[model samples]
Target: MSLDYLQLAGTKAKGKRPQFFADSDNERLLSILMAVAGELAVTRERLDTLERLLEAKGLLSQDEIETFTPDSDQAEARGLLQQEYIARILRVVQQEKEALEEQQHCQSNNDLSEIEQELSRI
Candidate 1:
């Protein structure tokens, strides 16, 4: 199913390139949120779906499921850390987009490229 966030005027985000969508700051934050959330939600859903399917198909036993806890303490801690990281990023991108919109520039590349850049740097 299409996501609710898909209806938002956000998908215009591309890059700092000369393309029109590339230069839009309007709803860039929204676009980013939608893209990332959609991916994460799909992943979570797929994992859960697969878990159920495996159980039904006898490909995985109950003990296997019990051992494979994505929500375990360590996994949960990491998830929380990642969530905070993304939330902080989106917050910054969102505020920047709003500021740019107020100035009518509405085209600042979301300037949200730092996080991914840093990740790639690592």
Candidate 2:
């Protein structure tokens, strides 16, 4: 798991650094995406190495690797993890969605209370 290959390509600037992103939000999102991409690249390299080793040992073939499918439970778990990965990438969106849902819930509760009061008056 040597990350020497993942080093950012550039020499450090001698003076004050210019902004890579237009704003703080873009900068944060870019950082998150870069980190995720770097990790995924490392994992992909390791998986490729493993596949080559297995093929060399006569235990697996390139065709088998391409066609590989998990069994039922494994497939389900993989699906769940895939969903989680998407959520992680869109975590800000997920948080905003949850906040909106909570706001709607409170509005709905208030509406319900108003309806009940009108009914009581009637």
In model 2, the runs with Cα more than 4 Å from the true position are 1-20, 87-122
The residue-by-residue lDDT of candidate 2 on 1-122, one tens digit each, is: 11222222212335653459888578657755864797599879999899989999999999998998899999887776665555545544445466689999999999999999999999
Per-model TM-score versus the true fold: 0.32, 0.50
Q: Tens digits of per-residue lDDT for model 1 on 34-98?
A: 65787688779998898889989989987887876565787877776566546543653655667
Candidate lDDT (C-alpha), each? 0.60, 0.68
Top TM-score hit: 2
Clashing residue pairs in candidate 2 are none
Model 2 lDDT, full chain set: 0.68
Which ten-residue region of model 1 has the weakest summed lDDT?
Answer: 1-10
What is the Cα-based TM-score of model 2? 0.50
